[model samples]
Target: MSNEQVVNLNTKNKKINNRQLVKLSIFFTSVIAIMLIFLTNVYIVKEGEYKVVRQFGEVVRIDDQPGLKVKIPFIQSTTTLPKVKMTYDVTEEEINTKDKKRIIIDNYSVWQITDPKLMITNVRSVTGAESKMEEYIYSVVRSELGSLEYKEIVNDEKSSRGSLNEQVTLKVNELLQKNSIGITVLDVRMKRTDLPSENEQAVYTRMISERESKAQEYLSKGDASKNRIIAETDREVTELLAQAKADASVIRAEGEAEAASIYNQSFSKDPNFYSLYRTLESYKKTINDETVIMIPSTSSFAKYLQGNN
Candidate 1:
């Protein structure tokens, strides 16, 4: 081999070596890129969550089971949704009833995402879903409250006013279900219901007035009853005293009649004896322990006392 041939061969060998190195680098880079894509597309569906796989802004698959999942790199994206129950506490709202009464109502609800696909399709994000829920709840609550009277809404009397809470919950659930917001309503409760400050003062005043009126009525009725009882007792006592006097008079008259009858019978039986008995009675009256007769002889008493005539 001459010197030029040696130089040309050396150059060709170097060019070949450079070409092989470039090929090896390209191969390794391609392999690494493929590996990175594969790693990036892989995801895991955690517990209490559901993953939605989207391709080009369209949902292509849903991973509901807890396991590892793979998708096309850079083309498919995954979104995780909470499968657990969520709670929301709505602020107090002022509402007017059919009876033109204003009241403040505070409420809360427990809900869960039932259909992740529907939730994602209808509402883009969890915050969006929450907003939609609040809107729906507000509308439903307002509508239901508008149909009730103030007494029915605030009264705890189940028999007289009925149960407004049950009706409200049922109506709200039906409305949510009809709208297809992919939410399951677990419970709806009214935390508080109160009258406005001005109205409360008015109610208190009215209540006090009613109580005073009732007290006055009771007092007047009691007085009337007492007077009636006293009058009746007086009438009864008068009647009793009159009857007693009439009974006494009748008894005295009967005794007098019996005594007169007895005296007449005795006089008719012995007129001579009765006369002798009268004369003896007169003699006894004229005589005394100390005999001091200062009578004439013509006098009947003096003759009787001297045992003459």
Candidate 2:
């Protein structure tokens, strides 16, 4: 081959290489465009999610069924909201009871999205739905529990534990039905309802004072009963003593009368001998070994002594 022939061959090879570079660039651009289109238009709706497609800030449709999805490229955008039940723990709020007692209440709610389009129209997202539901929840809780006494709603072994929480949930659901947010509250529960720290001591003090008053009343009643029993016992004892004394006096009088009658009968038999016997008995009773004789010799005992002759 001549040098000119070699030059022509080299030029052909260079042209061929440029053509191949253009073809490669076009192929790579097409691949990048296809990838971009797929990313913007194609999406997957997972098992527990609802994909909301919006066109120009307006919700066009909701892809609720779990599968692959497609949309118009460059004009459609998507977001997902959970289709399963959700829970929101509301912050603790201070409330008042029907008795004007201040209490703190902490509660939670279970909810779900029933209408995806309505949710997007009003709530727009799960967070907005929760906020709207919580608003109704607060209203219902305050009204329902506030209609009851402080002790009525409190949980205790003695309390009947009524359906206030359930009623509140029902009312919230009822109220939420008017709003088109499409969230249905399954339940609302109060985890705790307690007196504020500042009011607890005061309430406890009042309770203690009431209890003490009742105790004092009982003590008063018991004391009155004890006094009544003592008075009755004293009356019975006095009556028994009086009756015993009267019987003893009657018995003593009868014995004295009988002794007089016996003495009269015996003296009627021997009057002079009775006089001598009485004198001797009197002398024996009145005289002792220490007695001194100061009587004249003419005494009645002097004759009895002379009889010794």
Candidate 3:
């Protein structure tokens, strides 16, 4: 080939090579674009995730079932929410009971998003859900506790089964029904109920005073019962002693009367014998081992003592 011809051929070859390179580059770029498109449009709903596909800020698809998922590229976006149960600690808050007693309460709640679409529309996120739930919790607690007396809430004997906690839980669930988030509260628990630091000392002092008053009242009642019992026992003993003395006196009088009648009858039966017996009795009564009985022996008593006619 001549020089001009050879140069022209070289130029043509260069153009062909450049065109091929452009085509190849376009091919590779297209392949990359397709891959990118596929990657962006495709998604996976994991075991514990709820997938939501939104178009122009509106939910179009929800993939709660765990598997591979796909959607239109550049026209829709996906977001995933946790399908597992979640717990949120409600901050400590002070509330006044029906009796106007202030108590500090803190607690937590377990909840799950039953409907992701509703969750998105209402709460929009887990944090939002927690915030909403906290609000509900506070409202329910305030209402429920306010309906109860301070002693009723604090007293173990009243609703020993923690019915107050249950009441709050039920009321919370009911109130949350108005929430479009479709959240079901699995449980509501009380971390603790504490008296405000400012009220603690005063409440404790009042409780102590009440307990001491009850103790003193019981002691006084016991003393009064003891005094009454002692008085009753003393009266019974006095009556028993008097009755025994009266009975003894009656028997003694009856025996003396019987004895006197028997003596009078014996004297009436034998006057001489009675006189002699009386003289003998007098002599015996007047005499002792150390007594001188010379005058008594010389009198009629001597004759009666010798059994003389």
Q: Which candidate number would show the highest TM-score if scored against the true structure?
A: 3
Model 2 pairs whose backbones collide? none
- Residues 1-309, model 1: lDDT tens digits: 999999999999999999999999999999999999888999999998989999999998888899889998889999888889888887778888778888888888787888877777777777777777777667777777788787676667732223555666677667667777777777777887888888999978988999999999999999999999999999999999999989989998998999989977997799866766777887688767996767788876556567775
Ranking of predictions according to TM-score:
3, 2, 1
Q: Tell me the lDDT of model 1 at 70.
A: 97
Which regions of candidate 2 deviate over 4 angstroms?
Answer: 155-162, 214-309
Global CA lDDT of candidate 3, please? 0.86
TM-score per candidate, chains pooled: 0.60, 0.67, 0.69
Model 1's TM-score against the true structure: 0.60
Give the C-alpha lDDT of model 1.
0.81
**What is the lDDT, from 0 to 100, of the residue 251 in candidate 3?**
97
| lDDT (10s digit) by residue, model 3, range 1-309 | 899999999999999999999999999999999999999889988998889899988999889898888898888999888889988899999999888999998989888888888888888888888888899899888888888788786677774326767877787778777767678888898878899999999999999999999999999999999999999999999999999999999999999999999999989999988987887687688888898656465568566556666
Clashes of 1: 0
RMSD of each: 9.1, 7.8, 6.5
Once superposed on the true structure, which residue ranges of model 1 sit more than 4 Å away at CA? 1-36, 158-162, 214-309
Q: List where candidate 3 sits over 4 angstroms from the true fold.
A: 1-49, 53-58, 66-79, 159-161, 246-287, 298-309
* 10 residues in a row with least lDDT, candidate 1: 158-167
